[model samples]
Target: MTSLVAGALLAAPGVAVAADAGAPPQPLVGDLSTWGSPCAAGEGRPFVRAVPNLTARLYGAGDHQPGEASRVSGEFEAWWLDGDGSEERLTFATGMRSDSTPFSWQLPAEIPADTVISWRVRAVDGEVASPWSTEGEGAPCEFVLDRTAPGKPVVTSADYPDNNNWTDGAGVYGTFHVDSPTDDVVSYVYDFQGGPLLRATPSGPEGSADLRYLPPAGGVFMLHVQAQDRAGNLSSPTYYTFRVASGRAPAAHWSLADAAGSRTAAATAGAAARAGIGASFGSPAPSGTALTSTATLDGTGHGFLTPDASVVGAGKTFAAGGWVRPSAVDSVRTIASQDGFGAPEFALGLRQEDGGPVWSFAVNGTRMTGGLPEAGEWAHVLGAYDAETGRARLYVNGRAVGEEEAVTPVAAEGNFQIGRSHGASGYRDRWKGEIGDVRVHDRVVAPAEITRLGSRAAQLRGHWALENAPEGISAEAGGGEPLKLAAGASIFRAGDECDLLDPDCIPGDWPLADEGHLSLDGTAGYAATDKPVVDTDDSFTVSATVRLADNEPAHPMTALSQGGVHGDAFKVRYTPATQSWELVMSHADAPGAAETVVARVEWPDGGQGGGHRLAVVYDDATDRVRLFVDGHADAGGTAEFHDAWESDGGLQVGRGRTADGWGEYLRGAVDQVRVFSGVVPDQDIAGLM
Candidate 1:
């Protein structure tokens, strides 16, 4: 007798020793079963469906069995059908397993979402092998993995008391509530002060939590919260930050961080400086800070504080500025108006009197006009008066736009009002839209000082105007970094030209309206950022206003791109052949490349030329890309582009890099090019227009 047969008979708990007459032992049979997979029912049971991320435990019981609990030694084999009509064998252990069942195996990893997996298992003992057990109600297992991530947590309320000075309190407490997208949220992680992340417990009500922390001596506190689902998927975090009187105290400052609330003075600036809140306060404007809010006004009412002779003395030089967003191109929206009608003191506002919206500064009736800003956009308006030179200057976006000389200055008597004009016509010329970071200085401020304030407040990474030419190196407005233009690029001043199709079609101000555009020669002309403006796979937005020159070409004209290789990174290209604009995102490995066509739109049949403002946003949380044309969602937009981008070269404008050399040069005028480090909301994109 064979040694296998002898051992089988001796070790068997209840089995009649039988020989196959030198032939293969009688085929073994038992029950084939699966566990752990939700779709699996019982022994020899068929599976209905399983999730792709799940691991199915397949096991089989031997027929000539030892005791029910005894370990059964055997070899197991399994196979499943692939999507392409091919059979793939599964790897199995040769030794019997002793967990749950005598023999068990886990299905392969990532079995494709929503795929029908038909698998069979058989057991073998030496030369004896059992026929594949029939699946009860035999059918292939189907599964669909839950690949979607939960929505971001909504920060409903974040409130913290203003801890003004060193005396009021050392620590401030804040309460915030985050509404989870689903009920499956296991917990929330609160990242405070960038220290060890803390898991928040359910506090007041269901979705709220309390946060209290002491500031780092003179520093402030910052809190960010993220939610985690039961499946271990984490939602994007939201942040809130509040200062604790760290910097120098201003003579008079209104942070305007109140949302539908009363305004207050900085504790360090003294309590007498609080400005009276206006009734026409609308909603909150973007403050750039997490916790603080900027007040919005509906062009009515006004906030006023008792005049501080030291800061607003008509005889003393003074500088005033704040962030403003106008709702429309209406006449005279005041920022600061002191001393009512009757040839008052000083009044700062955006006036359309000089044919269009201009930042106007008036002191003792002598007025100066600055560059006009588009409606529905934020602008930094600053005006400074030199008591000695008798000169009052207006600066818009940090550049001196207009200036005027005056005789000896005269001090006026009245309260300093914000957002409304103090005219004999009662409350006239109420400033519309939002205002924030309003400050007043007793001393005259230089041009360089105003630029520094604007730059610091904007917190921008790259702001390229492309106005400088011939070796076109323009200073970035947000930071005075030099942006080098190469390959025969030239400046295209809007000049005496006007594009009627463009909404900013005012013929007189067309030059300033479109400003200066960088023209590329459709060859190897482009501009590059000094540093990497955007990072690979980061949440960032690239926006530019592009006007195609009158020429039909065969190749694509790249307006802007990163990642030197044409086939491997983000590219905004316009193909003249098809009159189509496309945003392509691609990924590559040593093996090959894969691409996600983020968006592609053809110019409506006959529509061509003129300026089209295009924006592409990469939303980090969703791993998706969105395309906007003319301030709206493009025909092809909001698509998935999860490929990792290569950060090999500096961000380029007007051309794409390839193996040969620079190519896909854009033969057009590109202006107002901006790169931001986060997803630009739709409404903001619309305002870009």
Candidate 2:
């Protein structure tokens, strides 16, 4: 058994932020109409004031009689009137204090907890006194001062195992018992392993919460629960430790559930093995309410397990898998390894060679490469090596990237280590990333099995259903080619107003349109089609569903365009000036000049809206270019080109031309794009719409 050493807890900077209070209060004179004389009502409140802690003050001025000077010659008096008609008076000088001018007073000690105190103010100068200024008729200003908090909540019920440990696959439910002597408990705040604070309002004074960490990845999570009274006083926190086993036990596994730890225990079946941590650790993955979590490792540090037969000795036919989100890849970032540095054994990580990061999997010191994942994104990676077939394969998010032959088995002297490579000499090649659920198996895992356990990222025909994730990809997806995101490109949640344009209109399924849309910010926002879609002669149909955002500086925005302004190239654009939808086709008319034929249709609804179907058809047989809206043709015109338009440039979406000089980048939702080699007949096009 390896000694378990607890690492120091180093709080991550800015991991959590307190909620922001709105703008500061602006001062104003109080209305004295309701009070009938002396004092005037002020801005801010008749507000609630918490006693013995936080407080609210009503500010106002003394109203002078008709014959008196505007400035009353007396002190402002504030009355703290109880609901039962009892009152106490407090006084403060007018305007000499913090610019709020009116009388301010603390809740009197006689005021009980959770009691409401109504108030009114009057001005008194010697024998002269003004009538009280009330908030409403017989309704004085009211404030509540709460000085007490709810009792500490008890962990009434926890569904952890007998030993307070758990494995994946089971659900977790915990109920907190809260009681307040002075006020009703209003809400509960839960913090799991210091990741993020989750708040839940109780139906009444008590409630049960599904305390399970989201995504259900393996790890140790410390649970802290606190109850808040209606008065806003939070109870002392109650804490408990929960150990979640990996969803599935591998030959050996390290869930890395302990956020601040130098030692992590293996969750493999009936195993008590542990690994020693090196250097400082980082906060756990900030995946609030997410289904999964990870631990961060500094590039200069790593964790290593001694020669564990059940894990590293899983032999030649084995599988290693985990989730890694890298911060940078300038140097090699090790995910998991049992092999020596550059020596025979087994290892899976990322290495930058040829100037870009690539998946690096090795068997017997022969390194094989796989496709790289975008930086700062979670990628489920699996490396399977089969000794019998001498085949080694690497997969990212369920998609197979690369495979190689002549793979060897694990070295006999290999000691399993994570975030670092260890050879006969020592450990090197540290990692800098968030890694979670490290699992090693004794059998070569199949691609189907790996895909089943990964995230969903479906790709097809240069179109990706990003919201469904890469896992939802079918065999025929991606046009047999993968989509590569341009540098700095990303997928963001479409605004609430985005049009889904769901073709089937599946009930309750608005689809990915508004959930995950390709985001283009005009500058450096574009994606490369894994494969090129070239125009077939001068006859082709371009179709796309789009929602044009009212982005100012509307100049002209292109949804889809091909190559340059010359040769069978085409562009779909919304012209702000003309309020029309235009399809521009440019063809070489002469050696140095190109003739452009444009088919323009007054946009539906005068082009003042979004979520419209746009398509352009060019047919050589009819010698006409036509535009379609929804399904029917909107406009058509005759145009004869010098020759069949053609260009070698791949089709561009969200922008026209290449990154070197992109034009009219779209600022809206673009989805369901298709390019047919030949002009699609009206019937076929209608069916598609």
As a whole number from 0 to 100, the lDDT of residue 418 in candidate 1 is 70
**Which pairs of residues collide in candidate 1?**
none
Candidate 2 lDDT over 1-689, as tens digits, reads 11112221111243221111321121123332112222222332322224432122332134222332333222333344445555544443333333233334443455454444444444433233333343124334444556666777755434453246463422223333433333366677887678779887665433433443431345675668887765567888888665665444467766665546656554644354455555233445423113245677667644443335436553456778777778878777778777544553677888887888887887777777877554565677788776656678877765677656575566565567677776566676776777776777765555556766554321113334434224322111444444445643455554334445755443321322436555456555555453456543435677767666563435677777775443326767777777667776665422344545465555533213446777777754334677776776643533444344556666766766423356677765555666665456676765543
- Candidate 1 local lDDT, 1-689, one digit each (tens): 11121111122233223333422123223233434443342243333233322222222234333433423343333344457655544434446553235444555554543333443444433443433332234433333333344566666433433333232112222355666756656578887678888887545455545554434233566678787754456777777655544323455776666445555433224233444555333345543333245666666454443344334775876778877777866777788777634644787888886476778888877888867565665667887776756777888766787556674575775667677656665656777777777787655555655765553222246777766654468667776445688866777665446676788776532221245767777776788876577765556788888876645655778888877444536878887766777787777522235666655564622224457888888864346788888887754677876565546667888887545556888876777888876666677886654
lDDT of candidate 1 at residue 511, scale 0 to 100: 23
Each model's lDDT comes to 0.59, 0.54
Per-candidate TM equals 0.35, 0.35
Give me the runs in candidate 2 sitting further than 4 Å from their true place.
1-249, 266-291, 301-315, 339-344, 373-375, 411-413, 456-689
- Position 523, candidate 2: lDDT: 55
Which candidate gets the maximum lDDT versus the true structure?
1
